[model samples]
Each structure stands twice: as structure tokens, then as C-alpha cells.
Target: MRKIWTDGLALLGIALVLGGCATSKEDLLPHDHRTMLDIWNVETSGSAGGGPAARQLLDARQALRRPLTEADVQAAPSVQARYTRTAANEIHRQFHRLPNPDLLMYVFPHLAGSDPVPVPGYTTLFPLYQRVQYALPGERLEDY
Candidate 1:
């Protein structure tokens, strides 16, 4: 009887939770279709850029902002060109790969497959090291 009561209470609790979750998002949210910008303007209506702090921020920004002259615009290209990547600058080649010797392998001709067909011999080259190694910048990549 006690187990039956506990099971009934658990079912009631689950039904209550499901009922709470069944409310549509449209019912929960404001039905008035006000835009985000409209809401922002309404919220900040009385204090829009009129506060002392806002005035000080605007003044500081005005002081920092400078109009670019024709000379400044012309000089911009030279400054950018100095830092631009070129073949002579060698900016991309920061790390040098360490040399790994290739090992030559020759496969002898043999009969292969269920029908026993003659396979031609071939030569192949493989790197001695399993993985390629790279030297850090300023490290001696050349053999001494």
C-alpha cells in the first residue's frame, strides 16, 4: 500500500512538471512586437548621451580622433610595404627541414595471385627516418 502511494505521488509530480513545461514561448514572452532598437531607445530615453560621463567620453573620443591628411594617406603605403611579405624577405620560411637520407629498395620478381602470374621487379625510394624533422629558427640546420 505504501509503495503504491509513493508511485502515485511520483506520477503526480511528473504530471505537474510536464504541465509547467507545456506553456508556449509566445505566451511566456511579451506579445507587444517592439524592436530591440526601440526597446533600447525607450530604456535610455531620459539619459541618452546627456549624462556627464557620456559627455566626457564623447569629448575624449573627439580629442583622440584625428582626420587623415593627404600626406598621411600617401605615407601609409610605404609603412605597410616595409612589413609586407616578399621572396627576398623570407618571412614564410621560418623553420628549416632537417635532411633525411633516402633508402633505395628493390623488389625481386615473384609469382603472385591464385593463378600464379609473374610480377615485374621494381625499385622504390623511402626516407630513412619515419617522420620529417624541422629545425627551429636560428638553429644550425646544416651538418657541421
Candidate 2:
């Protein structure tokens, strides 16, 4: 009995020690602190590696410094016209309307006024059309 108790206690102690060592360094940090550390590391290390990306960035900066020529100014309007969308086109682009079936509602003819004037019964009823249908996946309206 004595030997069994000692062996059990020894096993428990070994398990506790193993568990302590198994815990990761990241497990000790709070969630928000860990996220902040990750963001900080990315920002600090991102620009450290300089190569073709750096050269491309330098080229872009130089392009920005160059003065605009008369040809560039003349081409601006045509470029703008190609990209610019009208108000109606913009409205159509932003909103996605689903298709709904038309519903025809009939108003029953009834007497009106204190004099009880009889209203003529008519079959005329306006049919309410459903809103515009939206373009879904694989559905093309125009070049997006």
C-alpha cells in the first residue's frame, strides 16, 4: 500500500511538471496584447526587405514628381469620359432589386358623403409591377 501511494504521487508530480513545460509562450499573453504584438511586428518588419518592390516604389515616387505635359492634359477628358458614370447608371449599380410578381388589388365600390351618393362600379384596377431584378452570380447585365 505504501509503495503504491508513493508511485501515484510521483506520477502526479511528473504530469504537473510536463504540463507546465508544454504551455506555449503565446498562451501567457492576453488576446488583445498578442494581436497588438503581431501588428507591431508586421509593421516594423514589412519595409526591412528591399528588392524589386523597393525599386517599384521608387519608380512610382519619381513618376509623381514629373510635371504633367500638354498631351496628358488633352487626354484627361477622354479618360474621364470613359470611366465616368451617369447618375442613373450609378443608382442601378449600387442597388440590387429582387424580382416580385405583379399584384392586382380591387377596391370595392361603396357609397360616399352624408348624402349617400352611389359610386359607379368599375373593373379598372392598376397592376403593381414588382421591383427590378438583381444580377446574381454567373448573371451578366453589363461589364462591371
Candidate 3:
């Protein structure tokens, strides 16, 4: 019984030492004093204008301020067209849809019940275009 008790105590001591090592060393150190908001405020307050990130942001803003040349304006449409997407392209993407056209018809009065009853004339509507039509780039909204 004494031997069993000694062995148990030895096992417990080993477990305690291993458990201490299992904890991260970084966890033993003090936590950060500043919150996320504090960090963001410091970065955006312009007080750090000498920092590399601030200089880069200033350079980008200056580059954007440069006037666009005539050639650049002419090329803008092609660039916009390449990047732009039509309504039809968006609808047809990721889903399958059949082209169903709308039709308009007038139904004449008829009598075709078990006891021949008169039916009144009525008008019905359906889609004329089979597929969805998308507006062209730079097309006027008023035209649509």
C-alpha cells in the first residue's frame, strides 16, 4: 500500500510539471495595453505622417489628382465596357432559364359547358420577347 501511494505521488508530480510546460510562454507575459480602436486612431490621426503607410496614401491621392488626358478619356469607354456586366449576363450566370416570350390575345365569347353557358370576351397578355434583353453600356435610361 505504501509503494502504491509513492508511485501515485510520483505520477502526480510528473503530470504537474508537464502541464506547466504545456501553457504557452507568451501567455505568461503581460497583455497589450492598447485596444484595436486605439491602434486605428493613431494610424489615421495624421500624427504619424512621417510613417511609410501615410506617405504611400499621400502618393496615391496625388496620383489620382492628376488630370486625365484626351487619350485617356477616349480609352475610358473600352476599359469600362470590358469590366462592366450586362443584366442578361448576370441573370444567365449560375442558373438555367428558358426563353419564354409573352403573347397578347383576345378571347371571344363562347358556350361550351355541360349546359351551354355564354362566356364573356376577355383579353390576355404574355411576354413578346423570348429571352431577357439587357441595355447596352452608356445607353440612356430614358430610352429603356
Candidate 4:
């Protein structure tokens, strides 16, 4: 009885799937066909192209607009320049890397491995910290 019920559901599911595929794309869509771009253009057409909502929005924006004074124009660059990341600002200012003092170590001449080989003495610099550290935002990283 269980096997018969399972088989009947499986047959019904297959029939439904086949029935869904029988309807052509043409029948499913509207009689007047339009491309996605055409639909988007119609939907997004602005005040000039003539939508009442768009006209109202444009009028509101125009009402909010104010003419910039000479002082305003002059100060604009200074305000933007403060936050602008240039080579000088990047190296010296806000995003400066935390100071990690390098240790100068002199390695004496030594012999190693199965076959003894003479290694010349040399000075190498290693940072005090294992990894490079960066300053947190608004943290004072200037040398005291």
C-alpha cells in the first residue's frame, strides 16, 4: 500500500512537470513584448521625459539648491585637502606606521653543517617587533 502511494505521487509530480513545460514562453509572456532595457528606461524616465513624481522631486531639489559664495568655494578645497591622502600625508600623518626600532646585530664569523664552512661577519638590522605595527585611528603616533 505504501509503495503504491509513493509511485502515484511520483507519477503525479512527473505529469505536473511535463504539463508546466508544455506552455510555450510566448504564451506565458504579455502580448506586447519589450526588452529589459526598454522596461527600465520607461520605469526610470525623469521629469523631462514626463512623470509627475519625478517633476515634484526635481522641483524639491531645485528649491533646496543655494548659490555658493566665494568663501564657500575657497574653503571647499581646504576641507577636502585635509582628508585627501597624498604621498606626504600618507608617510607622515594620519596613517603613519607605529615606530618599531631596528636592532643592529653583528654576527661573528662562524663554521656550521657537516662540512665546516667559514661565514664572514656582517651587521644586520632586525625590527624589535616580529611584525610591523600601524597606529589606530586618532591615536597619536608622533615621535615624542
Q: Estimate each model's TM-score.
A: 0.35, 0.25, 0.31, 0.41
The 10 consecutive residues of candidate 4 with the worst lDDT sum are 39-48
Tell me the whole-model lDDT of each prediction, alpha carbons only: 0.80, 0.67, 0.73, 0.79
Per-residue lDDT tens digits of candidate 4, residues 55-144? Answer: 676677777897888999999998888677888778765666899998999999999788999899999999999988887556787786
Question: What lDDT score is found at residue 8 in candidate 2?
Answer: 100
Model 2: ten consecutive residues of lowest lDDT? 92-101
RMSD of each: 10.5, 14.4, 16.2, 10.5
Off by over 4 Å in 1: 1-92
lDDT, residue 45, model 1: 38
- Top candidate, metric TM-score: 4
Order of candidate numbers by TM-score, starting with the best? 4, 1, 3, 2
- The top-ranked prediction according to lDDT is 1
Off by over 4 Å in 2: 1-21, 26-49, 77-144
The candidate, 3 or 4, that scores higher on TM-score is: 4
Model 4, position 120, has a per-residue lDDT of: 91
In angstroms, the error of model 3 at 82 is 6.1
Write out the backbone clash pairs for model 2: none
